[model samples]
Target: LLETYCKASGQRINHEKSSIFFSEGCPQVRRDEVKQILNVHNESLSERYLGMPTDVGQSKMGTFKYLRDRVWEKVR
Candidate 1:
C-alpha cells in the first residue's frame, strides 16, 4: 500500500530516513538521514515554520534541548 502511494505520487520513500511511526531520536546518522529527507522533500527548517512542515526538525522540536530534542523526536 505504501509502495503504491510512493509510486503513484512519484515520491521516493526511504524507510530508514523516514521518521519512526511512534518515537524520535537524533543520532549522527539519523540526523543526516533526516537532512536528506528534508532536502528531498524541500522542507524548511525554521522555528516559525508551524504544523508538520517538510523540515522534520521544526515539527519534532521539543521543550528542552532544542537541538537534541528535535532530533530525537524524529528518530525516536
Candidate 2:
C-alpha cells in the first residue's frame, strides 16, 4: 500500500530507515506481520519527537500528554 502511494506521489520511502509505532495493546503477532510486510522496524514508546509521545494507546491522555502540560503552563 505504501509502495503504491510512494510511486503515485513520487515520494521515496527507505524501508531500512522507516519505523512503525504500534499502539500499546497491538498484538505481537500483528506487529510482527506488519514489520515483515513493510520491512521496517517496530519502534518503541521511547522514540518521540519534540518531546511529544510516539505511542498512542487506548488512553487518549497518554497520546496528548504534552498538550496538558502546555495548557497548565499557560494557565499559570
TM-score of 1: 0.27
**RMSD list, candidates in order:** 12.9, 3.6
Candidate 2: count the clashes. Answer: 0
Would you estimate the TM-scores of all the predictions? 0.27, 0.56
- The lowest-lDDT stretch of 10 consecutive residues in candidate 1 is 40-49
Model 1 Cα lDDT, one tens digit per residue, 6-71: 789999877444443213455657656765645443322444334343335454545334756678
Q: Write the per-residue lDDT of candidate 2 for residues 1-76, one digit (tens) a residue.
A: 8878998999998876667778779999999998898888846556566676665558987778779988999999
Give the clashing residue pairs of candidate 1, or none: 23-76, 24-72, 24-75, 24-76, 25-71, 25-72, 25-75, 25-76
Worst 10 residues of 2 by lDDT: 42-51
Best lDDT goes to which candidate? Answer: 2
Best by TM-score: 2
Candidate 1 residue runs with Cα over 4 Å from true position: 23-76
lDDT of each: 0.53, 0.79
Backbone clashes per model, in order? 8, 0
Q: Clashes in model 2: which pairs?
A: none
